[model samples]
Target: MRYGMAIDTKKCVGCSDCVVACQTENNVPHGYSRDWIAETVEGTYPDLAMEIRSERCNHCDNTPCVRTCPTGASHVTEGGIVKVTHEECIGCGACIESCPYDARYFHPDGYVDKCTFCDHRVKNGQDPACVSVCPTHCMYFGDLDDPNSEVSKKVATRKTKVLAPEAGTKPQIFYLI
Candidate 1:
């Protein structure tokens, strides 16, 4: 099962609710965040187009983070969730350097940390904190391998894009435009 997330950019309001939820639920340090809202504005003046998205680890199928980890701390878990084993991490920052999405951060406790898609919560049949608390309900998460899953259906039906696709990471996060 390839777990993934589909975020509707048209529905997102740049409220940062998902960011706050991720921090509170993950117990992230005050200065750090596992996810954040990114906004892009293009064109000129009144003709400008704006896209706001909640961004985090892409959980790539061809993860450069996992490939660059000298200590094997960065690894892909079940359902394509990329995670760092804090105990095994040597704080080398290799994974952080390799991530095209700039998702990994060095923790205060001297290890790397990033989004997990709230694997603990997912295992309990609950959504990720970010997805659960999105006020606009723009986020959808489920097994992408299952054609009937919400995420899969959304990806199949909507116009979507993945960040840094040229990097060839095969990122699982989809931005529905």
Candidate 2:
């Protein structure tokens, strides 16, 4: 089944709890983020509004990173999750350069790094780290194919957007923009 995440930006409180949880759960390398938040402030002084986005691997359907990886170490799972194999990677940094979302990282261990949607946890019947620990309950995770699922329900009922639609990546992560 295809799985993805949909995050409600309105409910996000700019808390870093999700970030710290993902870092610990995935064993993501230090000095770099597997998941991070970005913000854009708009309008005049009195009408200021902050747009906060929690971003990671876009897990594009037409992933440039997957196509650019010489060793085939960076690829997408059937569930629409992008993963980089630390051991198989040559650390050529090609994927890092090719990723439009700035998702990939070249670790100090001489291998490529990126988010895997906490695959280990998912395989163990757990939600992705970020989803499980989001303090505001803004992040939702479920099978996109299941119409009755929470994620699908949100998609059907709300307005959402994916990052970099012009890139033709068809990202799995959606935002309530």
Candidate 3:
């Protein structure tokens, strides 16, 4: 279904609530995160504008991690979610190196780990944990292929950007700025 996300920068407050929620919901290891907050400040003092965004694996249509993995552990599901099968991962670090977003990390359990777009929760008819617990309601997740989906609508109507677009990953996540 080409699942994706749209995050409104105007509504985000850099609270990292999404990060915490994702970690809790995914059972992420201590000191490791499935999501993180990125802040960018422009100008100085009175003329300054700061942007705070929640960042994670983009679940790219041309996912480099998947292409680089030797064991097929990193693969894209039918619904367009890029997921890593921990049991099949050998922690060769090739996937981590291939990702331009620096999203995947070697886990303590000797496997690679990164955001899965919460495909488990999504399959159960629930929003991704990061999107659900956002205090400002800044995050929206749904099918990018469905024009009526909130995420698709926001992307169509708002000024949005994807990180490292030049890398040609064709990331599914859109940041509305």
The lDDT of each candidate is 0.96, 0.86, 0.92
List the candidates' TM-scores in order. Answer: 0.99, 0.95, 0.97
Q: How many backbone clashes are present in model 3?
A: 0
lDDT of 3 by residue, 15-106 (tens): 99999998899889999998999999999789999999999999999988899899999999977899889899989999999999899888
Worst 10 residues of 1 by lDDT: 92-101
Please write out the lDDT profile of model 2 over residues 82-162, one tens digit for every residue: 888777899888888888899877777889888888888888878988999888899998889999999999988999999
Name the regions of candidate 1 deviating beyond 4 angstroms: none
Candidate 2, residue 163: CA error in Å?
Answer: 1.1
For model 2, the stretches where C-alpha displacement exceeds 4 angstroms are: none
Model 3 alpha-carbon miss at residue 11, Å: 0.5
Model 1 accuracy (lDDT, Cα)? 0.96
Model 3 weakest 10-residue run by lDDT? 77-86
Top-scoring candidate (lDDT)? 1
Best candidate, TM-score-wise?
1
Error of 1 at 162 (Å): 0.6
lDDT of 1 by residue, 1-177 (tens): 999999999999999999999999999999999999999999999999999999999999999999999989888999999999999999998898999999999999999999999999999999999999999999999999899999999999999999989999999999999
lDDT of 3 at 173: 91
